[model samples]
Target: MARQTASQSTLNTDPVEQSPAESQTSQEAKKAPAKKPAAKAPAKRAASKTSSKTAAKPAAKAPAKPAAKAPQMKDEAAKADAVSTAAPAPKPAAEKKSLARRKRPRKAPATGPVTIGRSGFTKLKNISEIRHYLRTSDTPVFFVGATAFNLLGLDRWVRGFSYISYYDSWDGTHPRVFCPKDKPYVEFESGEQINNWLLRNHEVRAHIERRTPPGKRPQVVMVFFDEETERICEELDYELILPSHALRERLDSKIVTTQIADSVGVPSVPNVLTTVKDWDELVKVTNKAKLGQDLVIQTAYGDSGKTTYFVTSEAEFAAIADEVVGVEIKVMKRINNRPIAIEAVNTRHGTVVGPCMTEITGHADLTPYRGGWAGNEMFPTVLDDESRHAAVQLVRKLGDRLGKEGYRGFFEVDVLLDTDTGDVYLGELNPRVSGASAITNVTAGAYADVPLFAFHLLEYSGIDFEIDVDEINARWEELASEDEWSHMVIKHTTNSVERIDAAPRTGRYVLDHFGNLVYSHGDLDWHLLTNESEAFFLRIYPEGEYRWKGADLGILVTKAHLENSHGGLTLHAKYLIDAIRGMYRTTLIEGDEPQPKPAPAKGK
Candidate 1:
């Protein structure tokens, strides 16, 4: 079939399919070309103008029939708009699903009409079967790909069903999936021309597009990423799942997950993985194996503890032992730590757990990689009770052995318990989404319906999934010991400065001019601000204006995400100086106005 319509017109880009459920499918309507509507050329006959009463003024028209109808005018105007993007008024079916738990009964609440993010939070009813999960693969595309996930409203689950990305862009408008504005605009200017325009645009691929069962066509196209993804799938073909390349090749030897945590008995950091390549045979193997008593070397790819060194003298190993050559360091013993963190889910129906976080790494060096993220606190006594039952049986036995090795999605493991031998080691394994998944997607067990990412997208979404992970961990440990709510990831201490520049006129009430609404996070997630149009900016903080060294200053959901002073790294640097001293300073209102928008935590 003409090589399958030139391989479905170069579906966005391709290449990367190791099977994993054929990557999910939807090659965007053959690279979105449907434009041919403005071609009526030959009408330029104004070459020789005329005046003489307009060339003897054409013989007066409207001369018969309609003479008396000229007085009929009933207009009645009612249309005003400067920039209207309305689409948030549906979602009533008993709050959209799970009046508590229905194996099958919801028929409302999806407000199916309005939308946003991965299509209105995946249609409510237990994520509305991911809107009928591709009715059995491919051809359900709707990705306009502009971003801001329609400002995080997720376009009512992406206009419910059907999506493929770049619907038609450069604002010319044709986006059933949204791509307007010169379609891919030079394929986004760089990253090698967006990987050569998604492998020369095989019609924006999801295996050449077809929609589903009716005729059959989804070969595959799943893409889930976070962090570097090597120039966005260099030269593209598709098939990507990057939990930082399996955390840099199976946690790139955290002494091989500490020898897979001593062959799955998990408990670490009293380590030693020496390899004296130089630095004078690593200083005689740290003085004949006494191994720097209270040390920590770890080079081969370090994060949050910066190439993990800490010699403690020899002038800190002579100003850092020639930067540990032949890398492979691992020399631990630096205890007195307590992170915890958790969010597993590797299912075919099994590894589904959530409540256990405890990070807040004191922003290691103020921010960015050096900032061991100083904010996280999911109660439940951080860990103890046999180290939270041996760290939830070591991440449900490492997510049931990564779902028998096929590896499912949404990962997060981090251990380290030892508050006096409550010994539970396994420190890291974020397959993805582990900055503590917004503490399990806005908890209260996702407003009482249970959405720790809808059980990690219903584990591979072939459904049939069951729950009762010890009855949702004893109903989220009896509703987190009766509502405690806590979250904090405040990284942005100064990027783009604005602790209070001045401005807040539009409907005026974000406080400051003595009012108090000086919080942040767009218009309203907590206080509900939307007058001039709410989104001042602060939920996950991704709009702009940032600084204070650089990187991360967005998470701060509260309620005791961590108690006791000095715990989650100086309480996230004193919770960013109590959210920059609760922003507050309004009543100025000038040209680009903007200011008054802080209000986090919440009011009863």
Candidate 2:
């Protein structure tokens, strides 16, 4: 790739130093004044003639005081005046200018967006222009979060792109990622807390400050953040390039998502929203709404399926009664369904949708939670053409509605495809970049044009550009249909919390013809995986971290699907999982330790 030149408007070029001849001449002038006055006696007559001649020689070298001795120079000069009993001559105009220049501090370089005229702005209207803009941009863009997995390969496309992560998946070999030095352990309760900790870390803040251009503010993107994150970024002068935290929090609610979907003509599952205090209240609401006895109950907020409840009988409701009594819940009639996840960006032009893929969720071998998301599969036939079109329309509608609600940037939507009825219904909303982004960015569509995320970046880049959403979406859909990709997020599924003594490296691992998994080579991401025999593993919890149940161990990306038609793990997938799990070596923790509760059984 050709090296891009820095923007002239934002770059600061240092001033050239004085030549040796000039320095020598300035030194001679300064010494001449001190020597001429030294020989004069304490006289009754004023030495006007001698002072005039000394001032004419120009005291240029007077500015060359040693930085370490600057403070004492004024005091020394005062004492010399008291002893000599003769006043020092004033400096000439030219010499005074030189001294003033040396004393002034250098101005900081211009940063942030460059000022562009109407004509210059006209050039940035397409992907090629936008790509060039980013390549030459000196502004630093940071992806701050737990792992760099969401935007791993973005640095290759845009200059000044980097990652500030909590986990060092690359073991310090990857040049772009920055991890802070060790600090006292503080138990974190959420992704938001982890991110907040990183932003407030002294080492992390210093790292960002060093990389940041003198006057430019850093740009930050993360998978999760809250108001506290907003405050930290504000304190550090970082520009958080996403929707406002207040707006995101509102949209993150499952109840709010369902309401928004209804307003946009997008259908959610046949459900009723209400608080159920007991089994009798739940039954009454379901009967009044005509929902059947079998239902899926979901709290407004929770990760994966942890908050999702499968209630068929009084026994199941009693078990989870404590969780749902006061919270607003979405009670829906259970349907035979397949889960699909799609990522989209709500741009100024319109909503840009990426490829739709099947979600791998709740495999006991991979996760302890019954409905926990494991991975995703992208292939030509994941959905039929008609069904695929319907899904796209539904997602675009939701995206447009979200845009109207003052929400923009990247978001993931889960859609349930009813196997019996062939209807697509809104599942839930993740108001940020998701695990699926790894596969989404490497698709053939990204090759033909840019990744879906490129559009998101452009929205935050403060550049005005034009794009036809229909045309782009159509081309992406065609490209995605021909691409085959799949990835599994391997988690520590055991009940015990053990510290990992040794862990596998992050790179390519292949399965030989004899079924033995071997290390192929060290690579950054799974974008280069050529065949199903090989897989790319991004190790998350490296050596020395506690491996508790449901904690992410690593992510395995393969060229083939890992699930069967019935949504069960395939034999090949199981083989890969078992082989990868065997590579980890962990020691059990001593004394009292936290143990995860068993997850609920899978629902039909």
Candidate 3:
């Protein structure tokens, strides 16, 4: 790989320091004035020539203070340093008082998006408005961790932006702030816990003393799933409106999703619903539904194909039954369908769906399950018109229902198109702004909702809004299908349990040899460092006092694939994960402790 010249923001930038010779010259200049007077005092030795010029006045002149004082000052400074460090039991109270009285200058006030670490950016926009907003506002922002970050992208956009949003980068040390300054203090503990604390008591009592005045508090936008964001809002006496929360909860449930799909005239796979208490009844229902010998089960509201399951025997079902107690389970006929999912955005105007995505699956651990997932590829051979219409119908119906429920943001509805049968089924519906929302934001069909999810927050907040959903959807349709966009969130099939290492901080961006940029995450957190095609590390340690471990969460990539090249029943999807994992080095470990790093050579 070619090594490019380091940019100014890179670690290679150097700072200049004064040379020793320059220091000596400066020191000598201070002594010159004192020496001038000391030399004049020599008139006493030459008193016999006193009548010349003004030399007679020198006889009554004072001694040269400047030259005499210079040495004394230097000696005093040296003594002070020695005293401060060397004195173990005794020290002058006056010297200590003088030292403490020199107040330090406040650092440069950063006002804008936050950049991770000590990185500098090329340019920034919205400086004036954001600065005005911050300077005058009394509202406080809390920060949390575990950003929706996969790349260091967030560090670029959010480094100088605002008050902490309750939790910092989902990936690293602290809740990062762009508006005020980079606050590396948020990295301690879990981002989930910080957000939860806010929820539990509208204020972060331990760290801060007061709340942002009610009128000035900013709307909280939820880009990731954490139980506490809502709770904190309620406690603080602030309006915590995540429009997606209400709508997604309704549409997110499998039964609710299937029903909505049917209302919109979309068909689904044959399935039966089961609760925690009714395995036997579920069996009876499946038998009555007449699914087949092959079956698939789904736990409601999960991501990256974790909620999905395939079963062929009593034992397989039994293992899941034990783990997923009290959760709603959806059992369906195992159909030989090619897996395809799409990103959709439902604004106040209407719902706009992105290009089709084909999920990558089939790792050995998931062979028993068969369709185990690795990632998703967009532009997986376009779905036929019939299936496309079905997808539109499903999303539109859900969007309308969401409007009634006060949800107006970016959400993704998963559509499963059966290749063998030419049928469509609503596979999953993520009610909240989903992992695919970023793709939708940049689509030509979509107007720049570059900050799309924020609109959802506005709807639930005290703010009033009206949007032209139809226009947005039409525009979205044009852009969404024209170019293919894809994204995949990486997960560990063999998950660890022990907490090791530190958090992978978010809010930074990276590019490939092809020059494609990868964003940190939907939330600001974590950064992936890659110097070459093969050398990459997802640096996750955030500032502060918390510990992080597990199948170390790392980078996520969204790359375009050839049209219709990704869809398949099982064989095609299997290698994507193994291939992604192979691109970098990560060692699996027992439990939540961080993945073990390789030991360096003994003699090197």
Candidate 4:
């Protein structure tokens, strides 16, 4: 039987209170005869400082109160009781009648019509105002994607937030997860297609219609979306909260990213951008930039690790002739560098940055492709003070530049740190929600303020608000060293297709005395994960599903580092990886077997 980890009430805990000014306005709005407040409104506004408090301190247990205060505490308590027990003098008959009249019950106030965004409202001035606005909002918001890996746990920050996914990672238990029942075994080529499929599903359409009221369009967000996604959203009367696909496509190119960085005074690795049809031209271009023969060549689009090629000789160049010949590509000199990734949001006020994390790539035990992104590790020592500060500046400059180009919302950038010189250079750009967001939202800074993605949602929320980007960035930088977190994306590392007869369930697990993984219990997410010994595993392809090379098997998250200083998997990480892989029972498919096909097209 599927177990429910967190109930709706527990997961929807509100961590906001109105500012003094707003509180006064709200109090007046309640008592006004034109718009009376609900009878239960006062209870809904009760204070719960569970997440809002001083966050500069480390995440250790709170310090115990001093013993000397015990007697004073008792005397204070006694005086409070004495004052409460004291009786009041009798009132005159006229005054008593007036008091009775004021205490009579009144009818509840009627709700006003829903407004998109925060139209016609005062601009927000600080984090407290921003938090209170989002907490009380009723606009329907949906995250549509292949999986909820990117923006999971964001529902805690925003009201009326939920997810619509193609993969059922929650095993039909999570209250907020909605997966269509008409799933057919189609080999999806990209995440965009998966999102398009979900948008067109009949069950998904009905679900959205049920929650959405008349004359209101639901707000939709996704990690990977294209023109087709925009068109489908238009047909369904839903709002796609992102920049145009054309702008994103242009900025997605590595060459374009390099040029933009250059224009904005951000440095990139020494390289030249040109069309190289042969080895001779490539050598000429590299020599022009004073780059050595050992080079990294990347095409205009696609991630560098997946599409980038290393060339030191003519033979190496010939290996990727089809992809490189006559196409615009970036050829850079190889350097001893450490890759770092950081996420930021370009808001109307300015750019707000998140923590810097080291990227984990190309571990043989984790992934099949070379230099493929396996996971990310975020700790205090991930970067020195100088390098970390430089990365934040680079991201801020890039975000400001993108804002000028009419692009805004969430984006991730790759920053290359030269281990030899301690200099930081800008890398590629991801103009949407990224895989690293899973760790970004759970950091100490996020708990103190709001998750980075909340700002992205605010951009599309249609509310007029303002924030001090510099203040937020400074506070986050100081709190960076107060938390430690890491996650590894376990993929099918073999070159064959197999059927999973037995697979581990998605939930919490603990290691026993022998360092073996043991199931502890089910969980809603990694937010409540406590120690290094406990891990939360989210399964992608569950039991009885087909697994292929390079396919994601699952994700393992804990409160410790998974990679060492030498950029390799730690011993404990290996143990967990091996144990999880050991539980999978799969059988290879014989040759000449046809692959699974999609269900018949509707009306065909």
Measured against the true structure, the TM-scores of the candidates, in listed sequence, are 0.26, 0.78, 0.56, 0.78
Off by over 4 Å in 1: 1-208, 211-294, 299-385, 390-409, 417-420, 429-471, 475-604
Show model 4 residue runs off by greater than 4 Å.
1-121, 590-604
lDDT of all predictions: 0.38, 0.66, 0.38, 0.65
Worst 10 residues of 2 by lDDT: 72-81
lDDT of prediction 2: 0.66
Using lDDT as the measure, the top candidate is 2
lDDT score, candidate 3, position 176 = 34
Q: Global CA lDDT of candidate 4, please?
A: 0.65
Candidate 2 vs candidate 3: the TM-score winner is 2
Write model 3 residue lDDT over 1-604, tens digit each, in one string.
Answer: 1000000000111112223321111111112231222211111111011010000010111222332222111000000000010112332676334322212233354586544222232221232322222223233333332332211232222222222332233322333331112222221122223333333331223223233332244334433322234534444444444553334445556667676666656667777776645456566767888976477776554323334566777777787775445666677888766656555555544664555655544433222113433334445246665566666666677666656656566566666666667777677665544444434433433323323433343233332234555655555544455545443333333423212223343334444454333333443321122222221223222222111111223333333341233333232122332333433343222334455543321210
TM-score of 3: 0.56
lDDT of 4 by residue, 1-604 (tens): 1010000001344323323321110000111112211111001101110000000100111112222211000000000000011113454676444322111132244386443344324666677777766666767788986566667778788776778866677667666667776554443334455676788777777777766655466899876666667767765668899888778767766777799889989999888998987999888889889998988887765431445677899999999897789878888888878888788999998999999987776788976546656667788898988889999999999999999999989888888888888888886787766667878888888888889988988898766778889999999987876688888777766655555667887789887676667778877678888788888887766665555555577788888778876777888888788778877886554222444433222210
User: On residues 1-604, what C-alpha lDDT tens digit does candidate 2 reach at each position?
Assistant: 1000000000111112223321110000111111111111111111111100000011011112222211100000000000111223554676434322111233355485544222244447776666666556777788976667777777766666778876777776666777775544443434555677788776777777777776567799976666667766765668899998768767877788899898878998899999877899989999999998888887766445556777899999999887788778889888888788888999998999999988776789976657756677899999888888899989999999999999889988888888888998898887777777878888888867777888888898766788889999998888888999998777666555455677889899887666677788888667667888889888776665545555677778889778887668888888888778878876555323544433222211
